[model samples]
Target: MSDTHRWVEIERVEPGVFRARNARGGELHVAGDGGELFTPVELLMVAIAACSAADVDVITSRRAEPEELRARVDAHKVRDETGNSLRDIQVTFTARFAEGEAGDAARAALPRAVQTSHDRSCTVSRTVEAGTPVQVLLA
Candidate 1:
């Protein structure tokens, strides 16, 4: 396996708001108080959904290009005596393809593709399932 580490830098834009940028220079805005931008938890959900969708899309496209594709992730958060955390997460994916032999093949492969992504591929989902270690540093 290639040992490449990816990094994202987060900077405070203002009270309760921040901006994060990846090494590739892609940036996103985050808010802590449910502002106009995405919150951290929402971003996490997006990451998971996007990762799975990407894998599914590539696999499905190999059989037949989808005319339309969309993925949505819903998470339930619980806060109690123990602490606050995501209690459950659900992912839904939809794809539409042209009517033809290719479309038939793609339709047949869609379920397997999604299953493979959730069970094996989809790094973000796997990471979440495995649990991640976090460290904080003062700068």
Candidate 2:
């Protein structure tokens, strides 16, 4: 087997809107207001959100009782001295669960799940931290 970068193609659906298909046959839609291009940072944000949700789902499913699960992840990128790529990134994860006796356990597992996503699973997190550039514009 050879190392090959999996191909995912994106097509411009409309002004500032795009559609993409992943290697795993997943389709995604991306759009923006003001007819501006969707920056890679926005994709990173999407990735973080997706990963956090995936982690929460895994954790919640392992529990004995089926508890409602929800999560939010916020990431901030610090710029380099020369205003080039991102220098540092901080991500915060918040997870909420249905009321139950295992509430504490559920809460405690949130961090672990996030860590797993960041360290082991999330391709978006890994890609962003590895070197993908991110730029934010204020409307």
**What tens digits encode model 1's per-residue C-alpha lDDT throughout 1-139?**
7677989989998999899999888988899977788988999999999999999999989989999989999889999998888877999998999999999999999999999999999989998999888788887
- Whole-model Cα lDDT of every candidate shown, in order: 0.91, 0.65
lDDT, candidate 1, equals 0.91
In order of appearance, the predictions have TM-scores of 0.93, 0.60
Clashing pairs in 1: none
Q: Which residues of candidate 2, in runs, are more than 4 Å off?
A: 1-5, 23-26, 32-40, 64-88, 132-139
Task: Kindly list the per-residue Cα lDDT of model 2 for residues 30-53, writing each as its tens digit.
Answer: 665523544656675666677767
In terms of lDDT, the best-performing candidate is 1
Off by over 4 Å in 1: none
